[model samples]
Target: MLRFAGFELDQRRIELRAPGGEPIRLRPKSFDMLRLFAANAGRVVSKQELMEAIWPNIHVGEDSLFQCIREIRTALGDEGRQLIKVVSGRGYLFDAEVSGDPASFAASAGLSSASEQEGLAQQAGGHAAATVAGPAKKRQFSFGLRSRVAAVIAVLCAVIGFAVAAPMFAPGVVAPENTPTITVMPFVDGGSDPQATSMATNVTDRLADGLAKIDTIRVVTPRSDVTTASLANAPTRPADTDFVVSGELQRSANSWTLEARMTNAATGEVKWTTSVAVDTENTDLALQQSRLAAGVGHELAVRINAVLYPRAGVASPLTGSTKVVVEQALASINQTTRERFTAAQTMLESALANAPDNLDLQVTLSALQTRGIQMNWYSAAESTAAESAARSRLERALQAKPNYLPGLEAYCRFLTATNNFVESLVACAKVLSLDPWNGSALYQLGLTQIQLGRFDDALANFKQADRFDTPAVSRWTWLLGIGWANLLLGHSEEAVPWLQKSIAITPASGRPYMVLAVALQGSGRTDEAKAALAKAMVLRPGSTALNVAPPKRNASPVFLEAGQRFIRTLVELGLPAG
Candidate 1:
């Protein structure tokens, strides 16, 4: 029996039980999945690996896998989604600690072995009380015979129990290989300033600390001066590490840039390189340092994880026009305009026609479609078709390459766009679990929290995202989320600045303007509210107060009511009611 979180998994009985011993019902597939997770606790189990194991040679879709995951989570009361965590693109990780009872009752009680049973029989001949199965009148058997019978019965029971419980030894489970060790070399200071040298040292330590947070990679500090060039030339790493990270911190006129690269220790190949800068002018000194460390650390972590858990890829990578088309398509997604969205969609569709199996193209198109869904760019039927296509494509891509980060991000966005807030909670959390500094995933998490009416939690998430400010392209999203959440909590005055900040970053998105109007109206600024409403109307024409509010389907009652209030306020500001 395996035990975790006060629950028992009975291998012999093929059952799961609560702490009080009530049997928890699980579908056969779910039971198998749970058993697999229990056996490989703390390890990521890929989706393909799982389907192959659970269904064997039978073909299946990802829905079946998700259903099993859902059922397992429900059975384990894993509402927090911590027990069985989705590791973003890597796979599913059973994060819970597990233990098992390997010593059977016979061994613990000292009565199972043949010699022990013989000794028991001999002892029973003199003093052991024994019983025999017989009629009461014929029950007066010799103690030696009764004891011998008892010993035989005990031996038989032990053998039967051992045979029945043998499966708990976990036949298919195997230990994972050791984690890849990463050594963080000291940072080079580019400027002559004494402060720059101190900052570089601090950044080095901070980067190491951040990388250490990732459980998949082991971070080691270099004892002596180390450089990527030196490590590359050496036959062996000083600590026998797998990878080395070397970086230089430079103080610029307006910003501090940290350039870093990771090289394979044995091959001397530079696996990844990045340069990230933090604004020293606008941000506080400490905040700049924090962002500098997080900026580079987040990127390095992604690259390292990609190398460690590479997804299934095509024989040839996207190059030339295909690569440009893909990049352009993704850039257009950031524009947040209806025409740009449609054009980008067309571009991706055409490119995908040539390489239908390209995972990058598939995920990009799905993400663009998901963005359209979020922006209400589709009619009801088109929206349905888009959602279905996005989900199917993403599922297929993820099943093919379960640990791909882009696919995971797109999936989380799809879930949030469809208002699958409950599942979005899990998906977004998984993204953040692997990439803790991801602002986009954090925005999704906060939005889901808002719909669930957890206003304070939503605000906290948005603020946390703001603190990280990663992928600064997604900054406007969390800013808008913060403003919307504050408005939802009736802090209209406090919501105004964040909404304005969002508009300053991406003024084309009418939604932020709509939110600004709401905040202005709530603050009793009628003229300002009308002005904001007019700007929203210009950016998002033909939006009726009735349909301008978010889709009410599947939303919590409190959120739906608040949404209606937002719509009514828009109506008051001359928004069309049709």
Candidate 2:
């Protein structure tokens, strides 16, 4: 018997009873649903999961499941939707305070008793029926005559039951797992120019995004903690944050240099540090900033992973025959020119050919493919080929070492692109389970949740993504995600600032303009909306402004009210908003 919320369920009897001795009658299916939820309390159960659990072999309609849920909720005195929240279109979640002594429940359920076990199994109904079907059922009676068969079966079952029951008396087992955390400080701007400061912030943001892809580290966001002044003075770490990353920028004639350090917050010990210098005179400031950001982000991710996992051959893996090749590849990646990328690709390929099964080589190849895609150095067909190659390589890497974080993240991205959202979400969840501070995984997962119509989950993920401050590209993407999520959540006003920040960073891009237009239109700023839309058209001709499908409509009254408001704004703006 398990007790919770003033009710107790007897698994053997398959009955629910109140503290005062009244029986709460439930349909056979409703009772099963309640039992599962009670067993796995404090966890979010998706609708797909519930369907699979309760109606495993049947093609049951969602309405049937929902009816059972309604009946169960009514019996529990949960009148409103608040008790068991319907998380948008994804599934229902039960939220209630629960307390039970596991040992007491185990004893009361007679977990060690063969009779109790048999009764519980029989009470499970369909499961018992399924188990007793076909060849297994025949095997029980074929060897004996009718008179002896039942007695023989009884004796054999008794032996088997004792064998199963013996293990229940053993001590329970639980293992301790380390949870790694990291903090990303604001990027240091060596120059006094406002543009430079903004560039630095963007760089830090991107780095944080990249690092968050790793599954063994938690990244802290600078947006809510570190600031411009704090970067210079190295302020104390926040109580909840784990690691702090601080860096310095210095100008040297025509070149700019950046020195960064990652420190453990608890001990104030430097975990890793590196200095990078780039020529800024000939390169545009923005491009230079992006290059620096990518380089810093990649290196920081490597260092953090090493510290957290400490795998063999992770540090200085190419000390023997592949040393020169590895160095060449790394040097090429550090360069900003197209020629350098080609050289890096060649060197990485050679290294992989030499060690075809190497995990590091595979990861480097995937990273190169990502870079090529981002830079547009590869044509559309070429980019597709490159991504396919990367996916194949990452899959091989995972087969070699299943826990490889970089490989897992790369594969997850590929899966997402292929519209395998369920698997991708699971992979990203595993990444989070291993390392909670991974910003890239969080952002990607957030986007996937939004696609799945899990708005609240998407919002939560975006909020978490905002914690890391590394790399300018990641910063831009994170801000863009936040802006879009807010718009979807009907917070048009909150989205404006985020979209504006993105536009400020990438003025030539069409994305921010499109989002800004939506926000403007939503806010009833008709003239501004037209202007913003016009700019977006100019930026990307034949863009899909209103062509995308809207999110799944909810049954909430608030959504209906918002829809009315949206229509009013559309009328004011002189457009067919629907």
Candidate 3:
């Protein structure tokens, strides 16, 4: 019997007992997990090691392991994870002290080996007579026809069970087919100034070399310069060129400007273009070249990626001035008022009117519309219209810019809200590929993972969003996301503080209150839970367990049932049935 934290784990019987000697039931996996923890008490167990130990040779989602851990915590009444601590970005540790006497404990629980049993029997002065009779009894036993027939039937059933549930165990998304190819033409010196020539060559070389690092694209540098003459006019298609990148260098006194453009090699249509200006008088020439090349290369890679991966990878065709307008409009997204939302909407609409083909404006407008739908800032009819409009605009934006990070992140959030988990995961992943530290994309990734019952993974992603410190991390939804994941994982103590933080950030919203109610309820603070629910009802009048859907989730049966239970708790606390 291994003892720790007011409970004893009887390894032989595979049971845990409370201090009062009452048995605490645990599922087989939960018991095994507890056993592992007891064995390695005070040691951090990596997720990989835990998974392999508990489920050798079985292909299971990370969520399954998370579920087992949750169950073990519940059985131990370790809601705060004080005894079983989670080490962020690492694994878990059994922090409690555990000790036990092996042989006597095993013998008491009927787990002693034959030799040990014999030794115990001999010590008790009653073993040989019982053992001698046991062998004679075994000799007299025989397998009858009924027993043989039953064994055969059991074997057949096992075979049938294996054949039934194979497809559900399959792997995830397939990778892209082929790598995209891009040709970087030498930069043209558009000025008579002698400094411009060397600067142009350096910029072109640095840009091409930097862009070549993106594994998704094949960056090609031609053996000979593709002249500025061809770039100025419509250039002929180069062999095997999917896209063509060319730029011109201009110098005026101490300042230099590089104007770069990428085009469709076949149609000679401009796909992307940007200009960077730097003062060579203040900065070293090498530093100026490196910084300029890095900027140009980053933009070029985004454009190429969008074309290569059509689902995501579109750059917004907006100048810095135009981008500032969109950023200002996006600021009102989390304010939770129709007036604020509409003001942002009007700003985007005006910008779109001026530049109808601008992908950045379209993307911003679409995202604003989707946010309205999510926040219920629009009337029913208006929401329906907005959803349709947003989808259409986002589609057009994707076509125009293909891998626009903001556009993809917004689409991913929209997809998750609309119950499209698979597509959302893909889109969110694309956003991460372009900018790994994008908090919005990380948040979207967490939301999709939540719907799939991968709360542990979701929580990890949410923490990553915080670490990235993206603007989205400041949004109330970030804290709410972490809170909800903990609530779903049965970590109510942990959930309460996160939900409380969310409420502090955005008290006007109903979601934090609703989730806070559940966390409070789970923690046995019934009166506080009731107050939270009342606040939720006040914020969203006439809202109910039935009408207020749970975050577009279609998870495992256990999670679905747990969701129902949570709702039932809310209803019992006087939430409306409607």
Candidate 4:
């Protein structure tokens, strides 16, 4: 008798008990096969050995052996043969522990001692000789006693019910604690709609993004991991991650229902599972989507944190005035050209009034004001006033938090826009020194180098920017910078691929196509270059092909000539003169 994984089995009486105390019936051969496995726990029992133990004289087919194994698995809750794993081409093994008091049962059964059992036949022969009679009569008496002995064995089996029941009462050993790492796999769409798959991928990506914000947890991006494909395969261990989060999405009418499960990757043991439904017919799809994303992110974070760091508390950092101000500022920035600057200024003023010491808001205001000045969209007096106000705010922000990277980067941009390229370069270098992997700092450094006409240095900084785990916008910007720098160096062939990659990553941006046209024209692909320039014009109508403006302070004449030549090629490719 032995018990494991909520199942109890008695070898003596061939009885199986479910977790709820219900008897599970099985075929005779299935019971025998299970008994053999339980008796020799933690050992690999060969098929030939098992056959001889179960049927000493009868010959059985391979299919019969497999059928019996299947029946035993069914009786044990289909632990998927995990408790009794089948080694390919090497028979079966029972990996789990088996416990029972075999000695006590053997004593209670009044069974012969090991030596006596071995000598039973010889002793029986001696007794037959003493009860000698006619030869035929002696033979008949011996045979009758052998039949009676088999009957006695059957009666003794019925009397020892406790032997079969002992394993049922025995407690199971607890498993060891695990340090779990979770990976959320992309969801699968079971419905007929193919767009549902993309929706699922988007949801998974958003969940991963939200989780990545937490400092304690390590989240892998979907682009790098193939967890989604693993879930679709549904192997014994579907994903190679430490813990796998997989789900299915189905559309019903105008809503979507998601069913998800988190399981241990090694054991396939389920830790958590739930179903959530969201109405797709909401008046504002974006708000509904955000709600769903927040719900899932918060719930999963809470669950995982509870298990890993139960005492740690979660804080709502963005709420009240902070949330309101941030939302308004973002909305303002997304407005059309005519209203964007005024709307941004208004929101910034309001946010500043509420959170006077907030460094982020101060820096954002400075950057926005600097952009207005650099674009020459404001009057000279207005631009001067804005630049003065921005410089004052940025200085105050640095005074409050000297190590603020965002403030440092914003101040560098402000200096660069005001034609203080040397100061901007020093500020960007300081940012990089503090945080070597800072993408914005690297981008600022690259832009400063380009303005100073250090084309080679600019190319190196742009490559470093891309090497950082940067956002999509920064990545595109770095690639565009690299393309322009390569064109200046006369490596037009090298510039085309980088420029095309930039375009592929961000097709709506006009900068990559603009640079690509110069590279194409320099490489003498005039027709293609013209096509590229035309596309750029469609994207940015007033953009010029001539580098008419003088290089910023500290720029070299030779590098300036190179840039002008590239611009001339763009003009030949037929871009508009602004």
Most lDDT-accurate candidate: 1
Clashing residue pairs, backbone N/CA/C < 3 A, model 4? none
For 1-578, candidate 1 gives per-residue lDDT tens digits of 88998999887788999999999999988987787777767766555456545775454434356658767876887744578765522356788778884234224323234344334433422111111111111111110111344434433433343243223212211111566778788888976898898688667755665565454556666544455667766654565688989888888789999888888888888889999988887677656766787788778868876786554355335677878988998887866699999999999999888988888899999999998887888998999999999988887776665546787788888878887664565455446545667789878877876776667767877876776678788888999998999999999999999999999999886878989998999999999999999999999999997567787666879888898899899998989999
Q: Which stretches of candidate 1 lie over 4 Å from their true place?
A: 1-178, 190-198, 224-240, 309-312
Model 4 segments beyond 4 Å from truth? 1-319, 327-342, 353-357, 373-381, 471-473, 507-509, 545-551, 576-578
For all candidates in order, the CA lDDT equals 0.71, 0.56, 0.64, 0.57
**Per-residue lDDT tens digits of candidate 4, residues 1-578?**
56766777765676888888798998887877776676556655555445545654444433356557756765775533476665422346777765685333334333334345324432433222212211211110111111334323322321232133222111210111342446667677896676776567556644554454332334443333465445344563334356677788787877777788777667667777767677777334433343344445544554564455332222223356766766666444322243566777778788778777666677778877876665454676887889889988887766544434556667767766676664565455434423334556666666766766667767776775554324334566678778878888889989998899878766553556878988988788878888987887776567674333433456657766776776767766776555
Show model 2 residue runs off by greater than 4 Å. Answer: 1-304, 307-361, 364-387, 468-473, 506-509, 534-578
By TM-score, rank the candidates, best first. 1, 3, 4, 2
**Model 3 compared with the native: what TM-score?**
0.48
TM value for model 2: 0.42
Q: Candidate 2, residues 1-578: lDDT per residue as tens digits? A: 66777888777787888878699999988987876666545555544445545665344433356558767866786643345654321235667665654344434322323344333333332221222221111101111112223334433433343233223211211111454656667766767977667566555644554454343444555544445344334355456566778787676678767888877676677778888776777676645554565456656765665565454645335456566765666444423346677888987887788777667777777766665654456766897899778867766665544555666666655544444454555455444433344566777777665665555556666664554333334566667778877887888888888888867766554546766777877777768887876776566554441422222232234444543454454344443443
The better candidate by lDDT, 1 or 4, is 1
Pairs that collide, model 3: 306-313, 312-403, 313-402, 313-403, 314-401, 314-402, 314-403, 314-404
Kindly indicate the candidate among 1 and 4 with the higher TM-score.
1
Top candidate, metric TM-score: 1
lDDT of 3: 0.64
